[model samples]
Target chain A: DVKDCIIAYFRRSLQQGGGALSGKRALVTAGPTHEPMDPVRYIANRSSGQQGYAIANALADLGAEVTLISGPTTLRKPAGVAVQDCETALEMQALVAAMPVQDVAVCTAAVADWRPAQIVGQKIKKQSRDDVPAPLELVPNPDILADISAPSPSRPQLVIGFAAETENVEAHARAKRLRKGCDWIVANDVGENSDVMGGRENQITLITEQASEQWPRLDKNDVAQRLAALISERLSGKIDL
Target chain B: DVKDCIIAYFRRSLQQGGGALSGKRALVTAGPTHEPMDPVRYIANRSSGQQGYAIANALADLGAEVTLISGPTTLRKPAGVAVQDCETALEMQALVAAMPVQDVAVCTAAVADWRPAQIVGQKIKKQSRDDVPAPLELVPNPDILADISAPSPSRPQLVIGFAAETENVEAHARAKRLRKGCDWIVANDVGENSDVMGGRENQITLITEQASEQWPRLDKNDVAQRLAALISERLSGKIDL
Candidate 1:
């Protein structure tokens, strides 16, 4: 009778710790990577890192251990979550590779596709109106999403990537999901008229192997909460990836 | 006797309004220009706008009518100063041309020397690792410093430009002062080791037609105050420009 009472007490304590994501681990990437052209100049994007930070907080609220790897952003670090900052795509790639495998991985950083071929040691001088500088030589940066989503023993159970498209949002995202070998892809329109990038609100379509569902425009925090809930259900075997 | 008393009262009020910079109009440019490659991406620099903002505040404290033209930066606007924001170097150029002639103009912004030849309408899609993109094309941007320094009827009485140099600081700054036809050039080292670019402390060399003097490392605010004093001296005919 004493042994039975101890077992019941432990079970109740575990349930009280958290609901669905009690034992889950998550890795999240946010913000925009800067590709250095020189000591002073750089190529960068406009990712605010708000959504990624919100998602990390949401998952942690559900008792998931979340680690956020971010590029340069002014956002404050989320409470109860670990955060690491990186400047370039290559730096982020190395950190991601070194991290331990997790139950879920969310890739939301707008990594630069190309970087200057070489970083000039000195500031390039502008001679005169007659003198024109040569065109900028560029080379492709590493594809982090594809590398992480590749099927391997070390790969996470669920890998999700964000697709910022200016046109043909859903079709491009579906193709990207299959191409990157990720479980799901979140697609959003960032057309000239869409106030999505750096904005507070987001309208997204979550594309999965089963179906694609468009969500209404909502605050970035709400989007993060909704996505985190779905992740918990899927990880708990209540729904498919 | 009554008229003389009224004139004396007016003179006292004028003296109380401010010290050396009283009744002067100044235009200051700060921050780093962003040259857009596309809607989401741009070319930028490491300017924090601290030094320029400090200069604006210092000038205003001495009762100068200050108007600040700035690029993108996270720094808050200084009190008692008019601020106009711009993105690219071209846009800043247009705004500068539109402003009324000022008594003094300080060019401190690290404006981009070049911008993308064309801004892409849509985000450039990253296809695969093998799909290499072409090199980026760049075009020369209008030289605002040289334009403002050239002799003109509406030119400011005093024009000061900032020179960010790594080596031969004095020589480069002197050369810049002569080439741009500016009254003075504030030169600072932004070498790999120097922490002056975005740091609170700064070491500067003031280059003028008469002499070149290097000051010890001090807070950016102190540099602004010292420079403002010199500007007042020059404007009041106490010192040579």
Candidate 2:
């Protein structure tokens, strides 16, 4: 159902003049990075990657050469886009570091912040009632957004990060934009509106250095289109990044 | 694709004399129980629920009055079966406990052995580089198999548990069978066979008190059909429990 809906919107956008982002290269990350605890177990999030896929499709429809780095998800590849698959956060970081320079970068993937310190070579046995199980030791994952946003001659013209916050959505996002050094942060409160988390609808606030504009809840495709429009304008020097 | 194959197998089996399991009530658990760390994040396994679904369909085709207690999965409800949805190991345990007396029980869900001791009310904020992350405190989840296997007046005549072993498949499963007091343990070596974990084929060993039968690798549907037939014979007093 989600795939059909995404395809329908993608087709509609392709029919319209989508030359706004022509000649611009874009990199997008979609889905949740599964941090492996062991061979059979992982720490993961509920992100369905629907929003990320929609964004990639929207950008592709707008004529940008897009490469989508995706985590493990059930969704099929978006039409007219190149896709690279990775599972854990560290693997995703390596792929991102190796990508060619782009005009725009959108970090929508909900990368896990921590991973097991060591992957147990074997499946951990379920202990008897008397035995106490071990606690999960974790280490911080590579900061992909910060790495991509650092000052460098090869840095993309515009870098966007997404924040799924439970409280103080705007304040947290505003701080994250500064903290991560990204040009903009798309913030959404998944605390109460779980419909926006893995579901089809999304309500987001576009946070830039100068402005924080909350958009009405809309279909994920519409949100992608609007974000693509802003990205095109920013790249064309019609608007600030 | 998996659904079509399963449905086709179910139909072919239905055309055969499937009355062997008639008038018998069966309970089955399927999928991976997601143990939530927060609203958006969870500890999950790479279970696809395909094998479990196939088993449910096969049992139903054999004229068993089946109730499938399943964890979170993307699969649609199987035809001709009653389904119950659950998210965590504790929830699945509760559902199993509440089911009406069953003639046979199949525990195939890949339930997490431990859950976060305390579920964070808010999403855990991604700390700065200087901050050390806290270890994930975990506590053992309820042993659903042991509980269901405990001697009781209403205990099912036949109880089957599944073990996904990376090493010592037969030995671990034999020990598990005795430790959990289940009648049979279906053990599969997932070490060299990752495809069996989530894909559509399985090679398993059925360990019972009397003998161990090593079944050849086959399509998951066919495995289910064979296991269902074994269950029918056991319930009909032709085979040992």
Judging by TM-score against the true structure, name the best candidate: 2
| lDDT tens digits, residue span B102-199, model 2 | 99999999988889998988998886954546888888898898888989988999999999999889999999999999999999888844678888
Candidate 1, TM-score vs. the true structure? Answer: 0.92
Superposed on all Cα atoms, the candidates' RMSDs to the truth, in angstroms, are 7.5, 3.7
lDDT at B145 for candidate 2?
85
- Candidate 2 chain A, poorest ten consecutive residues by summed lDDT: A8-17
Q: List the residue pairs that clash in candidate 1.
A: none
Count of steric clashes across candidates, in order? 0, 0
**Model 1 lDDT per residue over B139-199, tens place:** 8888899999999998999999999887788888888898889999999999889998889
Worst 10 residues of 2 chain B by lDDT: B8-17
Best by DockQ, which number?
2
Docking class of 2: medium
Interface RMSD of each: 1.3, 1.6
The DockQ scores of all candidates, in the order shown, are 0.56, 0.63
lDDT of 2 by residue, A1-241 (tens): 6775775466445545457877788999989999988889999998889999999988887878789999988897887688999999999999999998999999999998888898998888886854546788889888899999999988999999999999999999999999999999999889855677788898899999999999999999999999999998899999875
